[model samples]
Every structure is written in structure tokens, then in C-alpha cells.
Target: MKPFFVILLFSFLILIGCKGEEPLNDSIIIEVKTAGEKELSDLINNRNGKYLFLNIWATWCLPCVEEFPDIVKLSVNYKSDKIDFASLSIDYIEDKENKVIPFLTKMNTTFSHFINGFKKDEALINFINKEWSGAVPLTVIYDSSGKQVAMLEGAHTYDEFADKLNTLIK
Candidate 1:
């Protein structure tokens, strides 16, 4: 009886020791909503007393993918109350769940995310910035008053992002 009890206790300890962490897929949840020109505009306009850092990207854009991890790091380092971070994916609205959300989940992003819902790509570009020329990896910064303070086109490094953000803070 004593031997059986000891074995049982040893087995329990081994099981506990071997326990693994939950898979990232099971632990992280990310939602990607569809946003049209009006919806995007609304988000840009509604700053809620915090500076907004919005990145326009797509799942298929290589530059966007390359720079995403830096954006994630920036989002983590910045104080959330002073600056809010979000991403807008130009990937098709239908891919929001399977492609966009999955990519964002893999990146461990928990901020607001949206997929393009505009009927015409031109409308979206015009709404964002007529001068944008429909480029991916566009970073737009808005002040607390919902004013566009800076518009950066193309992929940027972490230091570049930090410099821009620091100027905004100052």
C-alpha cells in the first residue's frame, strides 16, 4: 500500500512538471473588423484624447510584413494612454477572418485592426490622403485633436518610428 501511494505521488509530480504552456493560438484572440472610407475616417477623427498611430498595410505586401514586428515593438514600448496604436489591412474584406486576423494573431497584436471595405481602392486612398498614391506600409499619426500631424509612406525602421513618436510627444 505504501509503495503504491509513493508511486502515485511520483506520477502526479512528473505530470505537473511536464505540463506545457497553452498554445499561442488558444491563448491569443484577435479580431479584424471591416472598415470603409467613412468608417476609417471616423476612426481617424475619433482620437479620444490620445494621439493615434495608424499603419496601413496588407497581408500580401512584403514591406508591410517586414516592418510589422517593429510596429508591434513600438506599440508595446509606448505608453498606451498617451498614444494608441492600430493597423488597417488593405487585404480583401473577405480575408479579414482567415488571413488578416491570423496574421495579426501571429504577431500578437491586440490593438484595433480593420480590413479594407471600400468599393473602390481609389476612394480609400483619397480618403486617407489624396497625395498618398495608394501605397502600403503607410503610417499616419493624428494628434489628440484628431488632426493629421504626420504621414509617412513606405516601411520604416524601429528607430525611425521612435524618432517620429518622440517628436510627437514633444
Candidate 2:
């Protein structure tokens, strides 16, 4: 009886420990098209006269996650032919939909996904902004003429985001 009780106690302890040992969901993979030779041309030429809201973010950034809701709200509230919102995740190529896609799906984000395939962080930083300093949460708003009008780095509240959009819309 004593041996059985000891075994039961040990089993309970093991179960409790194992319960908290769930694996981290960060390694989930997403299917993303690496911007190849024609990718930039397609993105630019295809979006000739439309306003583009390009957000560069990653799943690990807290500020990026926090600001995502407002971006989603902005997309939902202002559905227009003149405006295009594209969210580009800097997550690893192998972990696109796995990590970032699930997060976006859970958040109900409607914007399209663009995943960066270049392993070199410097290339991405230089491509987005020469002075980007390799930040995770960077947003660039380009006007109809393909000129960047605003570039925001860091989390923004819904109202703050709305204000920015309002300026562009008007």
C-alpha cells in the first residue's frame, strides 16, 4: 500500500511538471514568396498610382504585436481601391505561416503577407530604410506617386494611426 501511494505521488508530480512543458509555438512555418528578381518590379509596377501602406514586422517584437490591432482596424475601416495595405513579416522563411501566419489569423488581420527571404539583415534594413537600424516594427506609407510620405517605427495607438491615415486620405 505504501509503495502504491509513493508511486501515485510521483506520477502526480511528473504530470504536473509535464503539463507546463508545452512546446513554444514560435517555430510554426508560413508559405512566403521570397522577393525574387521580378518581385520588386511586380510590387512597384503593379501598384503604380495607389497608396501603399507597408508594414515590416516580426513575431518576436512586442511593439509590433501591440501595433498590429490598429493596423487591422485601419484596413477594415478604410477599404478603398486607392489604398493598398501590405504586411511584410521579417520572420524566417521556414517559419512564415507557422509562426506569423497563425498570429495574423488569430488576430483576424486582413492584409496580405510579404515575407523577406534574404538572410542578411543589412539588406532588408537598407532596402526598407537606410537608417532603419534593423528595427522590427517599421511602417512606411507611400503616396500615389510611389514616394514615401511617412515612416513610423514603434507601436502606435489606434487613434494615432487614424490620425496618420486621415492626413494621407485628405
| The best candidate in terms of lDDT | 1
lDDT of 1 by residue, 67-148 (tens): 9999989999996548989999999887887788878988998678988888999988888888897878999999988888
Encode model 2's per-residue lDDT on 18-78: one tens digit a residue: 8886534434333445663256446645766788888888898889998888888888887
Query: What TM-score does candidate 1 reach?
Result: 0.84
- Model 1's alpha-carbon lDDT is 0.89
- Model 1 CA deviation exceeding 4 Å by range: 1-23
lDDT against the true structure, each candidate: 0.89, 0.76
List per-candidate RMSD values in Å. 3.6, 8.1
* Model 2 stretches with alpha carbons more than 4 Å out: 1-32, 36-38
